[model samples]
Target: MTITVFTNARLLDLQGGTLTAPSAVLVEGDRISGIGATDGFPEGAKVIDLAGKTLMPGLIDCHFHVVAYSLDLWANAIAPDSLAGLRAAKVMSGLLDAGFTTIRDLGGADLGLVRGVEEGLIDGPDLVICGKGLSMTGGHTDLRQRTDVRPRCPWLAPRQHGRSG
Candidate 1:
């Protein structure tokens, strides 16, 4: 297998809390093969001089919301599949550019959005989405009422046909 080597890097060792000078790294395909100094570099390997730039692993964002609105949370709660997917793609690019290589979507996402990113149908973060949130009737995310007014419990509505407390 062919190997690529990166040399002259300033390594940020997060676990050891040390900034190493003149560090080296080896990449066999997409995965990192080893890391240390160039003195041990294998023969006939491609080499890259990092020129003393810091080298670290990609960043991660544990909590993210791909579909969100500043003024209308209720509207986003009921957003259509197409629009939600589009929003997810846009947000994913922003997060990736900001150095977040992975994310865990806490809410407001369905499997289709995640699948779209995975299948390359959209450009977005690596997503782990909770299909939907759980909320009681008239609770924080209830969207049964008109956007201009507070939501009423379906059971409490005069036209309701279900039991109520």
Candidate 2:
């Protein structure tokens, strides 16, 4: 197995304190093999001289709204067409680029968006979506006013789901 080594780096161990001086890290393909002093490096391994750069694991955002911004939920819910989907894809890409490799979308996202991200149909972060958020009528997210803008009713807002109220 081929091993890639990164040396002369400072590491921030969140569980511990911080690592001072130059350190070394090893990676075998996608997984990290080991991490320690440069003396542990194997012969003929591809060595990267980090030159004292700080190294840490990829960041994760536990809560984020992938589909709609906080203030624009009404607009997004009203028109969740291709345009909205594209917007969501762009937002997800930005999040990933910002070092949030994993994100849990709190609300305003549907199964289709989640599937699109998972299937690599779009460039985006690894998404964990709640599909839709549950809310009470006129309690938190009442979208009765925006009905004229778009025909489809908000699926998550509390109301009569079946035949009766």
lDDT (tens digit, per residue) of candidate 2 on 1-165: 778898998888767886767888898877898878787677788999998998777788887787674465678777747877888888988887777777888776678877887898977777777767667765446666534455445874567657863
- Residue ranges of candidate 1 with Cα displaced over 4 Å: 43-46, 69-72, 78-80, 136-165
The TM-score that candidate 2 achieves is 0.71
TM-score to native of every candidate shown: 0.71, 0.71
Q: Per-residue lDDT of 1-165 in model 1, one digit per residue for the tens?
A: 888998997888779998887888998988998888677788888998988888777787776677874348777767887876677678788887777777887777778877887898877667787767678867766666646575655877877468876
In model 2, the worst 10-residue window by lDDT is 144-153
Cα error, residue 148 of model 1, in Å, equals: 8.7
Candidate 2 segments whose C-alpha is farther than 4 A from its true place: 43-46, 144-165
How many collisions between residues are there in candidate 2? 0
Q: Where does the lowest 10-residue lDDT sum fall in candidate 1?
A: 144-153
